[model samples]
Target: MSLFKKKKDELNYLIFEVTRKCNLDCQFCYNHWKRDNDPKAEPVKEGYTFALKTLKTVFKQANPKHVTFTGGEPLLAERVNELILFCRMKGATVSVITNGNTGSTTEFSQLIKVGVQLFELPLHSYDQAVHDRMTGVLGSWKKSKDRMVGLMKFGAYVVPVIVITKQNFSQVGETLELLNNLGFQRVMLNRYNLGGAVLASPEKVLPSKEELNEAFKQANEIAEKRRLQLSSNVCTPHCVVDPNRYRNILFSNCSTEIRQRPLTLTVGGDLRFCNHSPDVMGNIFRETIQTILEKSSEKYSVVARPDFCAGCMRYEKCRGGCRAAAQQTGGSFNDVDPLVNTIKENEETEIA
Candidate 1:
């Protein structure tokens, strides 16, 4: 901890991707792969046992503030119940991010009993037709919405995140109003990053600065009128947008909204600093998770702001949006943009 800078001590959020298998084929999946031969592209068939033991060892070694399970869809990952139980035994709060069609109410009830409190469901649009077209499923839209109702009724924190795209960006205001009407806890408006199959459409759908400003503005109206709390990312501050007093509230957080919970572990049982960094300290299967963590703290160093981002105040806000994306697009932290940096040497041109 630095004396001059208040380093965040509450380090306990883990974005555990239990599996890589997904149900719906959304064009904008952040985890989509190209060659399919990448080792990272593979999803482990090993379920709760591997994950349970891994979680147990990691939790015992480090006290996490919270644990968030995501996926291809976490519920589809077998032994989800076991992982939840282990987190509870370790006294860590548990959350799951799902598309919401993987489990039944019974499965959800089991999760709730095991101390799972936070649930995030992604709904691309309020209109079923558009959403289904985007997700390539007939009822994916309704199923996600219905599942949100279930979680809310069960008294769990259910947040819905919409990946803004040309397909759904126009109706963001309406989306907020409809979700508020449905009794949702919160909603985050995230622009569609160029990843997955949607990369070609990035500029067509990503939120304009003005659109984001309106999203924040509309969220406030829903907060005041519908008694719902709403927010948008990179668009508004967390304290002002997240509703606390009223029954219904809407809010948003730009990506990196909250410090992400730690997720990856080294092949040696040491935890990977962030999902983006492929390096590892140790492996839970080989040794103890904490032992490795304590031995080598240097491996997980925080990312220093790169030169290209040094002049941008929003650099702190973005912190190199996605390291994985950076790697994929060949845009290191030092570059202004990926495509610009990728210009071939033979293709160099001089403008008059």
Candidate 2:
């Protein structure tokens, strides 16, 4: 089977968690991004060599429609240029999600020279003090914003991801206004997933459903007015826009179109199925791309949940989703069932 998938397994989004180490600790971060427990050892530039080999395998396996570079902070990872090169090596449009604190604008520019098409960063709060307070670091707000400017200066497409929580929800308008003024092409508004220890206080992290719907409506309105894009993810909602033009949205609960994705390729080249699971799908270095898919597809059959899709009537679409967050956060399959069912009921009522 040569093990390299031709197109059947082609994915719409390939999210790679290149590393677990992060510089600053955001209070509402869903994963324990702050606590990188790699009893294995500390991070070093040496990691990139391993990264290059693994990426070659990923490019062949997924045949991604779009590939996203992500991490505790991807810019902190070694050989980002090499990784971008590999992703571009594929036909996939390349993008990255980052915290924007790294001090390598030149390196970022170098990646831009290639086919890295887009950059999404944290645009948490309008005021530096407020942003810094949420992130628990001084000057992070200033540094991150400056880095966003750096990305735009390089002529790369940019989108800022702001997680909505108690502290920052009230200031969403201010944040969007600033991004619009700065001429960013888009902003993705994220709802905090009360999963990791970072968001132990559900009270602070999970905004009320009414609040989220209202905010999404207003943000969409503002984004439309400014001609900017806003998006959310992780089982929140869905809104398909003009084939080319985009809008602010939640990335959560997307159809199976985006589920069943491995969150990370380990240092050893194994595909860890989920962020919290960290279990491997065999080492890509040893197996052919086709074999990798066959194995992962089988794994999904055993673990993926199709019946209780949280926000999808099309359970067959995304399967059970990446259940790592539910595992770690103490939610169950039932928790998501209501989400999908409730939305469906409301949708049906509206139609009726």
Q: Pick the candidate with the highest lDDT.
A: 2
All predictions: root-mean-square deviation over Cα? Answer: 7.5, 6.5
Tens digits of lDDT, candidate 1, 196-305? 54455555444544454454455556666765545443223222222233223333222332235255542123355454433355666665544555564532332555
lDDT (Cα, 0-100) at 296 in candidate 2: 61
lDDT (10s digit) by residue, model 2, range 68-103: 777777877877777777778777788887888874
Which one is best on TM-score? 2
lDDT comparing candidate 1 with the true structure: 0.60
C-alpha local distance difference test of each model: 0.60, 0.63
Model 1 CA deviation exceeding 4 Å by range: 1-11, 32-39, 43-45, 197-228, 231-282, 285-303, 313-324, 333-352
